[model samples]
Target: MASIDLYQIPVKEVHGVKGKKPEELLTLGIASVGDLLDYYPFRYEDYTLRDLTEAKDGDKITVQATVVGVPLVQMYGRVKSRLTCKMMADPLFITAVWFNRHFLKDQLKAGTDIVLTGKWDQKRLHLTVSESEFPGKGTSQIGTLQPVYSVTGALTQKWMRQTLKQALTQYGGLIPEVLPQELLAKYDLMPRKQAVALLHMPGSMEEGQRARKRMVFEELFLFQLKMQAYRALNHDRADGVAHPLDMPLVRAFVRALPFTLTESQKNVLAEILHDLQQPFSMNRLLQGDVGAGKTVVAASALYAVVKAGYQGALMVPTEILAEQHKRSLERLFESYGIQVALLTGSLTDRQRRDVLGALQMGMIDVVVGTHALIQEDVFFRKLGLVVTDEQHRFGVNQRSVLRRKGLNPDVLTMTATPIPRTLAITAFGDMDVSTLNELPKGRKPIKTYAVTHDMLDRVLGFIRREVAEGRQAYVICPLIEESEKLDVQNAIDVHAQMQFAFPDYKVGLLHGRMTPAEKDEVMREFSANRVQVLVSTTVIEVGVDVPNATLMIIYDAHRFGLSQLHQLRGRVGRGEHQSYCVLIADPKNEVGKQRMKAMTDTNDGFEIARRDLELRGPGDFFGTKQSGLPDFRIADMVTDFEVMERARDDAAELVRRPDFWTAAGYTLLREFLQREHITDSELLD
Candidate 1:
């Protein structure tokens, strides 16, 4: 084969053949042959098809065979589809049967020597191998460098594979190495061209593995550098060390606690206090699992801010939560005579003005509300600390907006989603993380059960009993429609059915389409127990936690993630009564059963998180880099646990060296920060 200029090759010509444009390819981070080579396959296909004599059920095999006879389409009574084809592999006779690929007749000609690789089930062999091309040497030669291109709708594997083969051969040689020699040797990464060439056309899985290692390291190393730079930018500009807190109030609030705080929570709270005590602004993340008492920790933090003779503001996702926090805090800090006010979107114009006025005038000690609290007019006379609830929902930009409202207010974010430590470090590495692993004493372990649709009546009867005893219930549905493919009952159907079945009881409904006011109204009725049963969709996935709602019935429980299920369960058991979480599901598959069993077996959010990651997936594990999550191309947070530790060590060493900043090899690190839009200017406290 002759060499060619990769950059000179008309990108439009190849994309024209693929029926896509260079821009679409750019979405996959491809612009030229060099880009194409950098793009590696997530997984590889093994074309080692078996011999016809060794065919077995459930085996994915490929074989070189001949359609010695004429190919005919069988018309099943209705069109009589053909299910089998007679083929010969020298000494053996084999059957090639496929479904839904009715066009194979035009592709596979009689006496045509071809290859078939697919699964064998029952007495039938399904074929994923539908490749057929006229050989230049009349089927006498087979290509050794088999290419597998990433595919999509209307584009077949055969077409993509062919396109990649031509493009790589004609345009792959011109790409140059971007990494410095010392860096390449230091990391032991394979050459760029070799990795790309072998990735698209590899002889074995080992070759594919080598290609992946090189690409993965490049992606992760760049990600780490970006995060470190962003953090440093923030640290450079620090402000606000207002002494806002009276120990008397904090001690009184803690003493009022019904149970002891976990040592982990205590340790984390201390860390936060220390940060608050520093002259530098505090930007910390408090992450824990469901039922880990993050609220109490938040309340304790709020007390510290108030005791320091400055106002504290807590922002939650919903008015119901904000009101709950207001009431809870007012009750806990009641001893210190701390005035707490609740501000919500639902408040009347006059009420909002009064609250905002009080806040600015320093009449309010702690202000709690939804996003409405972050409005520009909502000024704080002495806003020393800001605590955001469900931190993930409020992004870094949103939280920063809230902090910007004050003179460098300390920011403390709290979440019940206990991500794996590695993922936490990767995603939130810039923030100090504190884990609340232990639950407060007297917190009853929730009884979780997995039941099927057949057990609905018994479950409803139990719920009715609980309701009759003055306890409320939360019935969570996956959607609002009846899907034949799914067994779960939706909100529209569940609410109507429950109302008809229990006419004496009031049933309220909530869904995503409802206006915020409508949702708040319905939630208000349910929280007050005016609605005995609240049948809703995942809209109730978070917020509006009713302690009185002691029973949680989640239909199609297997459909929701474990962390989500745990959070929904957390809505209950907030009261003194024992709570039960019924996972209305069938053990449909191994994954479904495992998820259901995990929910039943444990209530630990961190453990549930690890299992969820293990169960959820690895590739595209965190949302994507586009979603502002730390990208882990090959480093599985679960599998590459030690790699992260080592990488962190390496990064620390690189930064500490005097000559590290001047090294030309760090160009990629500098460029990555600029590309990610993370700059020193963003660090303005």
Candidate 2:
């Protein structure tokens, strides 16, 4: 028989496979043998032989024992069967139970030696197993470290292991090696064929770890290759207009500010100014914590662009944020003889047309808006700069479309969500990064507290008292509307209850479901102090800054990530009055408790972000798609930082080689990247 090409053979053709029909395989996304190979185990079970008599509670163990008596088989409803048997090990008796294995009754005979692997319950003196096999049978997977595949529908672990074993037996030798042999030798990495075989069936623990490291390096290396490719492609892609540094607008704007700019802010502004003067387009990310005065720095850049006879656009994530920027820019520029316009979805036809006309006619020097600014009709006459606030909220496509409006206008992306330095570099290697590490002086930190659900009433009473003292308060709920799937407090329900609880105070509701106009109006009321208590969702997390709001209560706080909780807390403590954040939650798990504790322990946004990254993996910390990072199968952004660094350096060097794309090993690597949809040309385009 011809050896099957694992990449081309369908999974349904594998021998000794049952329970997985062709259509059923499609449900699990297993179209070919290659898909099965890529379907890595989420976790592994250590089935190394262990002493049954010394087992502890909740121990996953494997043992070899002889059956003491005939297995007692009991049938459940319809097609299910349960088998129970007792085993003897010198001085102790152990009971073993298997579920839904009716065939085991005929296979497991008295006095037969068998190996059982399962979770042992000490109190019940029984080993609970959904899998079992007799020793010396054709099955070679028992008593060894085994992979537990994530199954769907009627698929079982036994069937998947058997089918995958068949594939490995037939075609594991044909698994292509992508990394150059010299590179693998330099890193002391296992060969790709050995690693693939070991990942599915490792002979020992050390071998498995070595194989895993090789796989991780390959994944991170591919990601860095894509990033470096984009960076190289964009080297001279845009013929950016170099604005003159002799413009006096930036100096005058800084002098007119109410407070002295922090040293970090000044340094970041200098970096941005240098970028603005470059002949090539600027792709930069400006990251700062809350109250770091990033807006003022951006305003300075906008002022410089306007003074150089060019228009600028600032796109924010929310309508309220756009309004806030518009008002701030108007106050700053109107006094300095620069025109500013606001464009948002909530604007009427005439209002939008007027703003568009001003922008097209070079009358509006700076326009602040949300996604509406990226619409087809919104054109700029002399657009020189484009700024996006809360950058992670927008995707690469959105930001790229906005930049396309202007002929290679300098791009400045700002985010209050402070990512760790290493992750920022890995995720955004195509862009230059600047960080504002210092907050403006005199800004007080929000005092944070994590309280149980029973103390919620006291927290509410405190909010009531704070509002009564002529200070407004914010109540944040995790959900906008009641969700049957997720049982948590919602903004609408909390808004209704607050109205009844505090009859005299004006409580307004704000959630993502509301239109842009409604959200903006509610935010306007809250900012003006007309709404004594604003019950809302995370919509107010970023840019809704009300100085008078002195208290923030996050209901069901455990449902939120630590960084999100920190952002919510930042909404308070902007004013002179002492501010407080009450996290009302009864955490059901240790991770939830750790998140709550992390929030109350420190007010530093970066520290909170680091802790959040540790608690939740990179995928959940800031979402993979939002961060523009690929979903790596084995590499972790946290634990494998050193590996990623090495891989990044290697990739950076590899891409510079003349034959990198066509070399023998690299040709296979390129094909893998193409299959994974990480092609350089696709992303660079």
Candidate 3:
């Protein structure tokens, strides 16, 4: 059968999947036989038989024994029951108990031999049975590694295992191998079919590990292949804009800045300038820690592009950020004759029309806006460059749409959220990365502390002292309003409490629930020192620059990821004065405590990001779905990073081959990509 036909076989057609079982399987994303085959277990349970004498308390083991008595079913509270049976394993007799499994009473007869797997209590000679099997019954799960899947309603692990076994038996042979034979031998990888079989039914833990390694490599390799293809296609495109390299003009503008640019910033700016001079469009990611002066580097790039007789568009995620960038860029380029305009959703209809007209007529040299810049009516006459701020906040399609406004315009994406090395190479693998590691001179590191709720009064007192000395402070809460489910403090209540605590100081509130105008007003007041203390939510987590703000108090700080806490801390320390961040949290778990320790230990965003990835995993680190990261079923972004790196290297070499896609050895890969709809255009998208 053809691979496509085999993949299209419905789950209902499988031998064991009947009735609502197909629907249940579908809920787990298994609609077809191919999906079922690819539905790998998230983990496995070991049922390898062990000697009863060697077992210790709380040890998960499987013991083979002969039933000495009939199982007894005892009714418990409110529809609950327990089934117990006495069994003899050589010199010792043990009792096995199953909760809510009363049906097992009829199955286990006296003198019947069976194998039971569960957690053992040695003193009581008891096994709390999770699984059991009769010795001769063909359905025995004993002495085998049991695959445990993540299932949905009515989809039990036993049923899933059986259905997967049936699917593999019927169609596993038809599953094609995408990796070439030479590559497999070089990596010492198992055959594709063998790996799949081992994953579902591994003989031992080592076998399972070997199988997992192969799958991880394959997933990473294919992902890197797609990224490489996108990069190649982007480079080969005919409509790329090769902007003029006017370094003399750009350097003069840089020289006129009030402060000297750090060596790291200069190096990164040089990299972006070089990309602008290329014949192909620039697709680059500019990453830096908070207050690392990414905006200045971006400004230089924008100056270079506008000087070359082209318009530029800067897209940010929030309206407040858009406005801030506009004002700063305008101030930066006032003497350089570059016109910067702000276009955001909050603009009046007449103001929006004027900005749109100016952009279309090339009157605006650089336009800063939120998603409003990507609206259908917005037009750019000679747009040569596109810069996206906090790039991860926007979706891939949003970025693509803004890029589409110009004719293959050079794209530069900037993010303050420092991405880890593993994610940088995989998630942003298609783009050239530039990092700014050094902060501007004389900038003091923010002092950080983790304290319990009892320290709240002291923290507030410290903030009052800072405010009394003419510095602003920020109080952040987890929620905008009270939530019945969440016990964390809310911005509204915090704002009131802050006002009451500091009666003489101005207390302002800002949250996501506020309209853009309301947020901008509160921010304006805070920026100008009219508001001494600002009580807000994470809405201020990004791009809120208050030079005079020297203190930040985060309530329930453990509720946030390390990177987020780091970002909030960044709001302060922007000026020459000393800054401090107080984390008011009573963490209940080791991971939470570790996060607090990591925050108090280092001020480095990169280090914090790495730790965040380890603690929260990739999904919660940056929200993989929104961050353009693929959801790998078996490959973990943390533990399997080395394998990913190897796969990336191999993929780069493979893509460089002259006859990569057309080669006979790559026939299966080509077909797989096609089947998955991974076209060159979609790869970049």
Per-candidate TM-scores read: 0.82, 0.88, 0.91
**Whole-model Cα lDDT per candidate?**
0.73, 0.83, 0.88
Q: Write the per-residue lDDT of candidate 1 for residues 1-685, one digit (tens) a residue.
A: 0112454454555544545656566666566664554455556556664565576667666677888656656765665465456778656666777655556787667878777666655355344444433344353224343545565556566655666766677666655555456657887889866876777788777787787676666566555655566655566455667464566656666777877778887788778877887777887878886667787788888888877778888999876678778887887777777899989888999999999999999999999999998787888898888999887677567787889878888888887777777677776767767888777777788899999999999998999899999998889999888889876688999998899878989999988888778887998898888998999887776656687889999998988877788888888887889999999987668888998989988888878888887887533344443224544545566666666655665665565565656676666555545556765445422
For residues 1-685, write the lDDT of model 2, one tens digit per residue: 1112565787766675445376677888888777777667666788788886677899888877788877888998988888888886445577889888767777667788888888988887888885666767785556577877888877788777777778778768777776778789999999877887888888777888998989888888877877765566556555787888654657877988888999999999999998888888888889999878999999999989888889999999888888899888887777778988889888899888898998999998999988898888988998999999998888888899999998889999999988887788777767888999988888887888889889877888898889889999999999888899998999989999999989998999998988887887898888888899999988899877898999999999999999899888888888899999999999999999999999989988889989998999777876767777656676788888788888878887887787877776577666765664555445442
Candidate 3 lDDT over residue span 1-685, tens digit each: 1456656888788897887888777777888887888889988888888998998889999989898977898998867999988999877988999999898787787888888888999999999988788888786767778899998878888888888888888888887777778779999999888889889988999999998888888888888877766666556765688897688888998999999999999999999999898878788999999999999999989999999999999999899999899999999999888999999988899999999999999999999999999999999999999999998889888999999999989999999999876687777767888899989999999999999998888898899899899999999999989999999999999999999999998999999988999999999999999999999999999987899999999999999999999999999999889999999999999999999999999999999999999999888977767788878888888888888888887877887787886788787676766655555356455
lDDT score for candidate 2 against the true structure: 0.83
lDDT of 1 at 282: 83
Q: List the residue pairs that clash in candidate 3.
A: none
Predict model 1's lDDT versus the native: 0.73
Q: Which candidate tops lDDT?
A: 3
lDDT of 3: 0.88
